[model samples]
Structures are given as C-alpha cells and as structure tokens.
Target: MNFAEKYLSIRKHTEQLCGPLQTEDYVVQPVADVSPPKWHLGHTTWFFETFILKPFSSNYQIYNEDYNFVFNSYYETVGNRVIRTDRGNLSRPSVSDIYQYRSYVDEAMVKFLSNEIKDDVNELLVLGFNHEQQHQELLLTDIKYILGNNPLFPVYSEFKSEILNLPSAAQKLLNIQAGVYEIGFNGDGFCFDNELNRHKVYLNDFAISSSLVSNHDFIEFIADGGYSNFNFWHAEGWDWVKSNHIKAPMYWHKIDGKWFNYTLQGLKPVNDEHSVTHISYYEAYAYASWKGMRLPTEFEWEIAAKHFNWGERWEWTESAYLPYPGFSKAPGAIGEYNGKFMVNQKVLRGASIATPEAHSRITYRNFFHPHLRWQYTGIRLAK
Candidate 1:
C-alpha cells in the first residue's frame, strides 16, 4: 500500500477495535495509567493535526482550537494539555465528537498526502503513523483493563481463546558464544529514535530460554511460596508484594480452589499451556531468582533473538531504559518522544500480542516502571 492507503488502513483499524465497546465503555479510565478509549481516539488525531497538518498544510483549517488543550499528551512545546489523570473526568467532547474529529483530520491528512510530499514532511508522517500505532496497542490493553476491572467481568469480545493458544515450542535453552556483538537498528526502514546509534558490546557466554515462561511454570513458583519468601525478591519488590498483597500476576483470581484469569472473553479458567503475561519486572526477576537463573540484558536479547520465538509477550529484560551511545534528541516537541523517561524504568525487549503489525523489531525498546503490569508483559530466563 502507498502512503495514503497505509494511513487510512491504520486509522480504520483503530476504530474497528472499538466496535465491541458500548458508549459508556469509551469513557471509563479505571486507573491513571490506562487512558479512556475516547482520549486515545482524540489524542491520536491530535497528533496528526498538531505535527503535520498545522505545520505543513497551509490551507488546512483547524478542527477545534481548544482540542490541543484537551488532547495534547506530554509535549511541553505544544502548549497546555489536559492532565493525564483527569482525562476521564471530562465528559464533554463526547465519543461521537471525537470520531468526527478523527474523520475531519483524516480527510485533511489524505488530501495532504495526495500532493508530492517533501522529505521532512514524509518523515513526520511516518512518525505520526507510528505514534498512532503505539496508541492502538495501548487502546486495546486499556480497554481490557477497563472491562477486566469491572465486578461483572464483562466480555469485550469472543477473540480471547485464540490469543492464549499461541503455537508452543519445546522449552530449551540456546547458548550464545561470548564476543563483541553489534546491536541497535541498522535498517533504512522506520524505527524509533531510541534504536539509533547501532554499536558493539562485548558479552560473556550465556544461555537464554527458547520459550517464554508458561502459566504452568509461574503456578509452580506460586505453589513454592514465591511471593511469601523474601529471599526471592528485591528489597523494593518484596516491599511491593507486601504493600499490594500481590499473590499472582495481574487479572488472576483464585476461586474456591481453582485459578481463573480475566481475558477479553471475560473470566476463564487459567490455561496451563498459555504463556504467563501481565507480570511486572519485579515478579519476573523474583521468579528468575527462584529458579537460579536471571533475566537477559537487552543486548543479550537482541543478539539471541534470532534463535528463539518471541512476540508473544513483552519479555522483561535485565537492562534499564537508557539511551544508546551517541543518542541525541531531535529538535522541538517531536524530540520529547523517548528521551524524557530514561531513568527508573526497566527495558522490555520483545513485542506483545496486542502490538500492531509492522510496529515491532528486534531492536525496538519498550520500557515500563517495575511496578506496572497492565501491558502484556512476561518473563524469560537466562544464565
């Protein structure tokens, strides 16, 4: 597909994901981390209008002057925006209004793409495509969070079973030889700025698991008193466990004697064969420690990714989220994408089931605070 076609397709897919939701479902934000569905719809549209149409399309008319205040996320250079936690508090600019905003901006984007685009404009357009794709993944997971938290355990759709039944591979470890290995994005295709400055790093010999940690594997940890044992956890992790009373991974519920998980299809029995997901970095580390193994560093994951199956869940790595050598921020608001959140976050090295197609690569770096587990996060062992 050409530029305009790809743009339209991605935009349409975002809307399609919301097809199963009720109007009330679009406004609920159960937690501070999860944005309401309506906010995602409007914020993504605001991205295109703010970055591309306003700056490039001289003849384009602004949809609503106040939208920037309502939808702007964290771009300090883009002026004021609705505070993150208060997004759900606003009942104005209803869901229908956001859809209309998306339609209006999409029409403008299509018209702008019809002309021969300058190289810089084309670059920004690609970034806009990726920004929306990132939100698309967040949109699905956020929707899951909103519904999963409901006391009724509402089913979002009938598509949950298939995601849990990913093709399983024989569990084993692939050994890698110690040497200086090159890492980071080397391709000419689109990649986020954080993947730049491809460089070499010397690594000692190590072995990484070929398969992700399964639900059965984590259940064993729980049965062995993984959460109750302080030796298996970091000081902060153990503190987190006690403070939150976290026993199993998020969304896991223990009925009379059986374990069930909340999926998009609502609550269902925990499937032993499925990969364990929605785990925080702390839990991943504690589980690895309990097994006498460790999580692989991001560099180790990239070097060995080719030998194993990934993309099932966002595998937590041992590396912290930091810029690569020679990494620098771009000028203006666009530069605010990845550089600001470098500290106090763990890097996750693979894509999740909710990630959009063509949006992930071996070098793509995903980061989250150690305590956050709302995303499809899992664990892999290394030694």
Candidate 2:
C-alpha cells in the first residue's frame, strides 16, 4: 500500500480496537504507566497537529488551543505539558470531545497527504503511523489492565484467542553457532532511530529455547517458591518482589488451589499450553535463573530469532536499552522519541500479539522498567 493508504488504514485500526469499550472505559487510567484510552486517542491526533499540520499545512488552525498542553507528552521542545501521572485525572476532555479532535486532525492530515509530499515529510508521516501503531498495542494492554484490575472484572470483548497446539516435545533449546553477525535495520522501510546503524558483533556459541516458556513451565517455578527465594533474583528485583508481596504474574490469582487469570474474554482458567505472559523483567530473570539459564542479549536474540518462532509475546532480553554504535538523535521534538529512553531500562525483543500488523521488525527494541509487567511480556531461556 502507498504511504497515505497505509496511514489511513492504521488510523482506522486504532479506532476499531476501541469498538468494545464503553464511554466510561475510555477515560480511566488504571496505572501511571498506562495512559487513558481517550488520552491515547487525543495524543495521537495531537502528534499530527503538532508535527505535521502546524508546520506543514497552509493556514492550519489549531483544533483546540488547550489540547497542545494536555496531550503533548514529554515533548519539552514543544512546550510545557501535563505530567505523566496527571493523565488519568483529566476529565474535561470527554471521550466524545477526543473523538471530535481525532476527526478534525484526520481530515487535515488526509488533505496534506493528497499533494505530492517531499521525502522528509513522507518520513515524518510514516513515523507518525508507526507511533500510532505503538500506541495501538498500548491501548489494548491498558484496556486489559483497566478491566483486569477492576473489582467487577468486566469483559472487554467476546474475542477468544486462537489456541496454538505445539507438541510439548517440540520445546527444545537450539544450539546457536554464533559468530560475527550483523544486526540492525538496513532496508529502506521505516524503522525507529534506535534500530539503525547496522553493525556486527561476535557472539560465543549459545543455545536458546525453540519456543517461549509456557505457563506450565512458569507454574513449576511458582510451585517451587520462586517468589520467596531471593537467590534467583537481582537485588532490585528481589526488593520489588518483597515490597509489593508479588506472588505471581500480574492478573493471576489462586482460588481454592485452582489457578485463574484475566484474559481479554474476562477471567478464565490459566492455559497451560499458552506462553506465559504479563511477567515483569525481574520475574523473567528469576525464572531463567531458577533453570540455571539466562535471558539472551539483544544481539544474541536477534541472531537466533530466525530459528525460532516469536511474535506471541515480547520476550525479555538481558541487554540494556542503549543506543547502537554511531547512533545520533535528530534535532527537535521528534528526536526525543526513542533516544531519551535509552537508560536504566531493559530491552525486549520480538513482538506480542497485541502489536499491530507490520509493526514489528527483527531489529525492533521494546524497552520498559524491569518492575513493570503490564504489557504482554514473556521469558526465553538461553545458556
């Protein structure tokens, strides 16, 4: 598809994902890491206005003067904006109002794209779509969090996940003949700045599991007092576990010795065959340690990814989220996109089921705090 067509298609998918939510569902943010569904809707629209319309569109009037202040997230180069924690408390910009704002911005964006745009503008437009797609994954996870944490446990939708029946014996570690391998995006397609600057790194031979760690495997760790044991955890992770009294993955609970967890279809029995998800990096690390293994580094993971199936969950890696060699950030607000987040966070490789179509690449680097498990995160073992 052409850039304009792809842009419109992506935008429409975001709206469609929100179809099951009630008016009330769009405004609440259950946690600080997650933005409100309404906020995501507006903030993505604001991206086009702040980056594209205001700069490129001829005489483009601001949709709502106050929106820039409310929706501008972490763009210090733009102007002072709302703090991250304050996003959930916003109520004046009702869900309906946010939808109107999205419509206005979408109209302007379509008109701007109608002309023969320059290559630079085309690049920005693609980035905007990718940005929105990233938020699309967040919207789903945030929605799941909001409902999963609620006392009522309301069902988000009637969607049932397609079950994958992999033979239990198929789960084995593949010995990787690691050597000097090139990693990073090199094609003409759009990629985040963080995935650029292709380079080579030598890796000692190692082995990675052929499939993701299943819930049954994680349940073994849990049954063996995984949370109670500190030896399997990092210092900060151990503290996080004790202080929070975390016994299992987020959304998991044991009732009368039967394990249950929340899914998009609402509360359901934990599926043993499914890959365990909603696990924090700490949990993933501890689980790997318990097996006398470790999570693969980002480079190791990338080199071995072609040999195993991924894209079910964002697999945690041992690598820190740092820039590549010869990496440089662009000037201005756009530069702040991924460069500023390259510290003190762990990198995750692969994509989750929540990721939008065509949104993930082998070089894509997903990062989050080691303690947060709100996303679809899982563990992959390496030794």
Candidate 3:
C-alpha cells in the first residue's frame, strides 16, 4: 500500500477496533489504570492533526480548542494536558459528538493529505500512522481494564479471539548459541524512534522458551507460592507485589477454586494454554525465578527476537528497559515518542494477537512500570 492507502486503511481499522460501546463506556476511567475511550479516539487524531495537519495545512482548524488541554497525553514538547485523572470528567463533546469531531477532522485530513502532502513527509506520515496505531491498541487495552471494573464485567467488543496453537507445544527450550548479532529495526522502512540506530550486541549461549509462558504455567507458579514467597522477588518487586496483594495476573479472579479471566468477549474460564498476559513484571520475574530461570536482558531479547517473526507475539525479556547504545532521539515533537520512556521501566518484546499486524516489529521497544499489567503484556521464560 502507498502512503495514502496505508494511512487511511490503518486509521479506519483503528476506528473499527473500538467496536460497540454504550455512551457511558466511552468515558470510563475507573482507576488510574486506563485512559477513557474518548481520550484515545481524540488523542490519535490529535497526533496527526497537531503534528502533521497543523504544521503543514495553513487552513487547518482544530476540532475542539480544549482538546490540546484535555488530550495532550505525555507530549511535554507540545504542552501539558489538563489533569489526566479528570479526562473522563470533560463531558463537553458527548461521545456521539466526538465521533462527529473525528469525522470532521478525517474529512479535512483527507483533503489536505491528498492534495498537498509530499513524498518527503512519507516517513513522518508513517510514523504518525504508527503512533495512532499504538494508541489504537491502548484503546482496546484501556477499555478492557475499564470494562473489567464494572460489576457487569462488560466485554469491550463482541468479537471473541480464537486461540492459535503452535504446531507443537514448543514446550521444550531451545538453546541459542552465543554470537554477535544486530538488534533493532534496520530502518528498511518506517519504524518508531525507539527501534532505530540499529546496533550490534554480543550474547552468551542461552536458552529461551519457544512459546510464551502459558496460564497453566502461571497457575503452577501460584501453586508453588511464587507470589507469596518473598525470596523469588526483588526488593522493589516484592514491595510492589505486597502492596498490590496480586494473587494472580490482572483480570484473573479465583472463585470456588477455579481461575477465571476477563476478555474482550467478557469473563470466561481461563484458557491455560493461552499465554498468560496482563501480568506485572514482578509476577513475571518471580515466576521466572521460580522456574529456575532468569529474565533475558534487553540486548538478549532484541538479538533473539530479530531471529523470529517480527509481529507475531511480543516476548517479555529479562532486560531492565533502557536506551540502546549510541541512541539519539529524533528532533521535534515526534522525538518525544520513545526517549521519555528510557527511565524506570522494563522491556517487553514481541506483539500480542491484539496488536495491529502493521505496527509491530522485532525491535519495537515496549516498556511499562514494573507493576502495570493492563497492556497486552505477556512473558516467555528462559534459563
């Protein structure tokens, strides 16, 4: 797909991913865990509108003047946003009106992009498309967190995922020989700044799980006292786990001696073979330790992942998330994308089934606070 087709297709697919939601669902922010659906909708648009549209289109007009205040997200370069906790409280553009606003912006963007947008901006445009795609994923995950809070436990969308099993269990560990390998996206095409300036790294011989740690494996971790036992956790991870009293992964509830999980299709029996997701770093680390394993370092993961399918599934690595060697942030508003996240985070590799096929790649650096699990974060074990 060329620039415009790729842009519209991805943008439209993002909208379709939202599925059916009642008016109230659009504004939900039950805990600090999630951004409201409306916020994501407007934020993605705000990206293209603010970065590409406003900068290039002389006649471009913002749909909502207050949006930059309400939906600026974390772009300090652009400006601070209204109090993040109160995003749901800004009821000015009722949910329906937000759709109208999106339509208006879409119309304006189509005209501006079709007529005057140049080939030189293709990279920036692709970056904007990917930025929106990331938010599109967050839109699903955030709403999943939000919907899970309701007593009704509503599904974010009606579509149920059909679990795909690997050809074999991939139960056995595969040992990767020590070698020097190039890790990070090659800039063969459009990629986030975080995955740039491809570099080389040396890896010792190591074994990584062929598949992600399954729910059944995690249950075994719990049965082995992985969470309750303090020895398996790090100092801060122990404190985090204790403070949260996290008995299991998020969306998992123990009832009448059975474990259940909330999904986009609603609460259902836990599928043990499906990769255990929505797990915090502490939990993942603890589980790894319990299995006589250590989390793969960032270099190890990126190096190893480059050998696998790019976007199939995101793998959790042992790396303490940080910037790569000789890494330099791209100048301008877009540079804010990955540089800000270099501190105090854990690295995750691989994409989820929920991830858009186009947006994921091996070098994509996904980081999160060690305790946050609302994203489609999952772990693969190694020793």
Candidate 4:
C-alpha cells in the first residue's frame, strides 16, 4: 500500500476497534488510567490537526478551536488542556461530535497526503500514524478496563483473544554470552526519536526464559501466599498491595474455589495454558523474585529476543525508562513527546496481541508506572 492507503487503513481500523461500543460505552472511564473510548477518537484526531495539518497544510482550517484544550495530552509547549484524570467527566463533546471531528481531520489529511509532500511533512505524517497506532492499543485496553470494572460485566465483543500455544518441549533458558551488543533502532525505516543514537553496551552472560510465565505458574505463586508474604515484593510494591487490598491479578475472582477472570468476551475460566497477563510490574518483579530469578533488563531483552518468540504480551523488564547514552530530543512540542517521561517509569519490551501490526520493533520502548496493569502486561524471567 502507498502512504495514503496505509494512512487510510490505520484510520479505518481505529474506527473498527470501536465498532462494538454502544453510545454510552464510549463515555465511561472505569479508572483514571483508562480514558473514555470517545476521548481516544478525538485525541488521535487532535494530534493530526495540531501537529500536521495546522503547520504543514496551507490554509488548513482547524477542526474545533476548543478541541486543543480538550484533547492535548501532556504537551506543555502546546496550549493548556484538561487534566488527565478528569477526561471521563467530559460529556459536552458527545460521541457523535467526536466521530465528526475524526471525519473532519480525515478529510483534510487525505487531501494533504494526495498531493506531493516534502520529506519533513511525510515524516511527521508517519509519526502521526504511529502515534494513532499506539492509541489504538490503548483504545482496546481502556475499553476492556471500562467494561471489566462495570458491575454488569458486559462483553466488549464475542471475539476471544487467541491463546498462545508453546510446545511442551523442555523450556530451557537461552543463554546469551557476555559481550558488547549494539542496541536501539538503527534502520532507515521510520522510528521514534527515542530509539536513535544506537550505541554498544557490555552485558554479562544471562539466560532468558523460552516462553512467558503461564497462568498456572502465577496461580502457584498465589497459592503459596505470594501476596501474604511481603518478602517477595518491593517496598513500594508491598505498600501498593496492602493499600489496595490486592489479592490476585486484576479482574481475577475466586468463587467456590474456582478461578475466573474477565476477558473481552466476558467472564470466563482462567486458562492455565495461556500466558498470564494484566499483571503490573510489581507483580512481575515479585513473581520473578519468588522463583529466585529476575526480570531481564531492556538491553538483555533486545539482545536476546532474536532467539525466542515474543509479541504475546508486553514483557516487563527491570530497566527504568530513561534516555539512552547519546539520546537527544528535537526542538518544540515534538521534543516533549518522550524525553520528559524518562523518570520513574519501568520499561517493557515486546508487544501485546492488541498492539497494531508493524507498530512494535525490537527497539520499541513501552513504559508505565509500576502499578498500572490495565495493559496486556506479562512476565519473562531471567538470571
């Protein structure tokens, strides 16, 4: 597909992901971490207008002046906007309005891309699509969080996530030799600025698990008082567990001594064969400690990923999200995109099933607070 086709395909898929949502479903935010589905539609459209159309397209009209305040996320260089937590309270820009906003931007974007454009303009356009794809994954997760937390336990759709089926062959750890390994995105294809300035890092010999930790394995940890014992948890992690009274993974329920979890399809028995997901970094770390192992560093993960199959879940790593050795940010609002969030966040590698195609690479860096588990997060052990 040409650039225009690729752009159209991404936009259409975003709408399709929202196809199952009812009018009311699009408005509710179950948790602060998950924005309302409607907000995603508007926010993604806002990105294009704010970054691409307004600057690049000649005489390109802004969709809605007020949208800048309503949809801008953490871009301080841009104008002020709604606080992240209050996103759910918004109702004036109704679902209908949000879709219209998307249409308005789509019409302008399609026209802009149809004509010859400069490389710089095309670069931002590609960044916009990639940005939208990131939100595409968030849309599903936020929708899941919304529906899963509801008392009604409504199903988002009848579609069930495909379960990963790793062979029963002996799960041996792939041993990576200690040496200097080049890391980060070095390709000519489009990549985020954070991935640039690839450099070499010396790594000690380490072994990574062949497959992700299964639900059965986590259940075993739970059964052995993994939660009750604070030894397995970090200082803040134990505090979080105790404060929230978290006894099991999010969405898990034990009734009649049978374990079940909420899925996109609805409440169902926890599949022991499937890799455990919806786990926070704290849980991943504690689980690793419980097994006398540790989560791999991002460097270890990127270097060793070639030997094993991933992409089943966003695997948590021990590395904190920080700028690379020689990393530098571009000027203006784009600079604020990633460089600012380098503090107090853990890095995750690989991609989840919900992640858009071609959106993830070996160098892709996913980060969140250690306590946030609304995404499809899982664990991989290392030593």
Model 1: residues with Cα > 4 Å off, grouped in runs? 161-167
Full candidate order by lDDT, most accurate first? 1, 4, 2, 3
Best by TM-score: 1
Give all TM-scores, in the order shown.
0.99, 0.97, 0.94, 0.98
What tens digits encode model 1's per-residue C-alpha lDDT throughout 103-218? 99999999999999999999999999999999999999999999999999999988754253556678999999999999999978999999999999999999999999989999
Q: lDDT tens string, model 3, 196-268?
A: 6678888889987666777898899898888889999999999988787778888888879999999888999
Model 2 misplaced regions, further than 4 Å: 160-169
Evaluated at residue 248, the lDDT of candidate 1 is 98
Could you give candidate 2's per-residue lDDT for residues 287-363 as a string of tens digits? 99999999999999999998887888999999999999999999999999999999999999999889988898899
Indicate whether candidate 2 or candidate 3 has the larger TM-score: 2
Better of 1 and 3 by TM-score: 1
Model 3 per-residue lDDT at 66: 80
Write the candidate numbers in order of decreasing TM-score: 1, 4, 2, 3
Higher-ranked by lDDT: 2 or 3: 2
Question: Candidate 3 versus the native: TM-score?
Answer: 0.94
- How many clashes would you count in candidate 4? 0
Better of 1 and 4 by TM-score: 1
lDDT of 4 at 309: 85
Q: Please report the TM-score between candidate 2 and the true structure.
A: 0.97
Runs off by more than 4 Å, candidate 3: 306-313
lDDT for each candidate structure:
0.94, 0.91, 0.77, 0.91
